[model samples]
Target: MIRGLYTAASGLVAEMARTDVISNNLANVNTSGFKKDRAIFRAFPEMNIHRIGDPAVLSPKDKIDPKPFIGVLGTGSMLDEINTNFSQGSIKNTSNPLDLALTGEGFFEVQTPGGVRYTRDGSFTRNQQGYLVTGDGHYVLGLNGPIQLPDGKDISINRRGEVFSDGSFVDRLLVAAFADQRQLLKEGDNLYVSNQQPLPSNSEVIQGALEGSNVNPISEMVDLITAFRAYEASQRVVKANDDTLGKAVNDIARL
Candidate 1:
């Protein structure tokens, strides 16, 4: 009964974790450049079951025999990992010059207080210092360095990420792509950090637009329902085991 309780509790934990991921995805459905996370589960190792002859039924002179293999007993399961889905989201025109979007796999490098980080969000605005910055005020890095743009008027950014003012050249945007984005870890605020070296990006930038979040509300809602049902099932199993254990401790012990 104790083992059953533990096993059933593991299911509850796994389902709770899955629910957390689903809720997070749903919450970020309208967030720009947001990526959804996927929860993966793994089953515990199975134990082989075999039949053993009753010792009391065997004679002292006769050796006990082992019966044929019965089956396998499952212990439990757990949440293995939560992998972030980096699929591209739809780009929408915002009509703001600082707004940008990536058409392919790439990230915009920015200089933050916590060092440097990468993000797919291009909803940028100029800071008080006339430097192009993200919504969070992180400096938008350029090939030269932090891009300090001229006055807001007559500014244009090309698909090649080249900045121009009155047809005059300005610093190019620092668009970076990682060799393996799986190594990147989310650091919150729609930014990712990685130790891997960046590669030249083939992605094109679209100015006056922003990327939408990749989360699907309907799919996430379905998953949330499934997780809740799994959690309820586990709860029932736990209650059943508890009742059995109580019966064993009270009635069976008195027998």
Candidate 2:
């Protein structure tokens, strides 16, 4: 009875973790360059079931017979890990020169207070200092350093990440990629950080466009409902075990 209670409780905890991931995905459905996270589950080890007080173990004649095997009992399940889906998001045209979108696998390098962070968000603007920066005011890095645009100059970014101002070549955008995308960890502000060395990206940079989040609201809603139902089922199992234990301790003890 106690084992059942613990098993059900483990299930509840796993379902709650899954619910959190799904809720986050739903909330970031419209966030630019946002990726969705999936919760993976692992089952606890199975317990072998043996018949108690078997007659084969006691009697000499029955000693020749094999012990009876009942079956295996499942303990419960647990949350394994959260994985990010790095699929490309839909692109939307904004007709703004600073707005960029990647057509392939890559990330725009940004210089943050912590260190160099990478992001897919292309919604960029020129700061008061005439330096190109992300929406969070982080400096957008170029091939050499932070990209700066001269005041009152027309700007354009080509497919190869080259910046042109007033029909003059200025600097190239620092686009990067990772060999193992799983190593990249989210550091908030739609940015990812990884210890692995970055590779030069061959991805095309589409100017005047922005990438939307890849989260599908309908699928996330379905997952949300499924997790809620599973949580409720585990809660009921815990309650049932409590009632069974109460009867065995109080009601049966009275007799």
Candidate 3:
């Protein structure tokens, strides 16, 4: 009975973590360049049940097998990891020349408080210093460094992520790719850091466009419902175990 209670409690905790991931995906359905998170779980090792009884002295010729192969049992499960899906999102055109979007695998370089960071959010703007920056004022890096636009000249980002003004090349955007994307760590605020080997650039930029969030609302809703049901079932199991324990102690044991 006690084991059953612990198993149900573990299930409840795992379901709660799944619920959090689903809710976060739903909440970021409209966020630009946002990736969805998935919850992974693994079962814990099973406990060994051994028989306890008095044993008499055995004869010299008699022998007994101390260990026998019992059926495998699961104690419980826990959240193993949270995986990030880097699938491309749909692009929307805003017609703003400074806005850019990557059509393939890549990440835009941005100067953040924690040094250089990477992002897929290409929605950029010119700051007061005439420098291209993200919506949150992170400086956008280019081949030569931070890209600075010319005054009163219309800025255009070509398919090669080159910044041009009056048909003259000003700077090229620094786009980077990872050989192993799973090694990248999410630092929040639409930024990621990677320690894996960098891959050759293969992404093209499209000006006047923005990448949409990768979250699918319909899928997230379905996941939310499943998590809720699982949590509820675990709660029922816990309640049932409690009732059985109560009866055993107060009624059966008393009788």
Top model number, lDDT: 2
CA displacement after TM-score superposition, residue 71 of candidate 1 (Å): 1.3
Model 3 lDDT tens row, 55-101: 43366776544554456667989999999999999999999998888
Model 1 agreement with the true structure over 124-213: per-residue lDDT tens digits: 999888999999999999999999988856779998899988889989998899888888999999999999989999889998999999
Q: lDDT-based ranking, best first?
A: 2, 1, 3
Report the Cα lDDT for candidate 3: 0.89
Candidate 2 residue spans exceeding 4 A from truth: 57-67
TM-score for each model: 0.94, 0.96, 0.90
Clashes of 3: 0
Q: Which portions of model 1 miss their true places by more than 4 Å?
A: 54-67
Higher-TM-score candidate of 2 and 3: 2
Instruction: Give the root-mean-square deviation of each candidate in angstroms.
Output: 2.3, 1.5, 2.7
Cα-based lDDT for every prediction: 0.91, 0.94, 0.89
Q: Given candidate 3, what's the lDDT at residue 7?
A: 95
In model 2, pairs of residues that clash are none
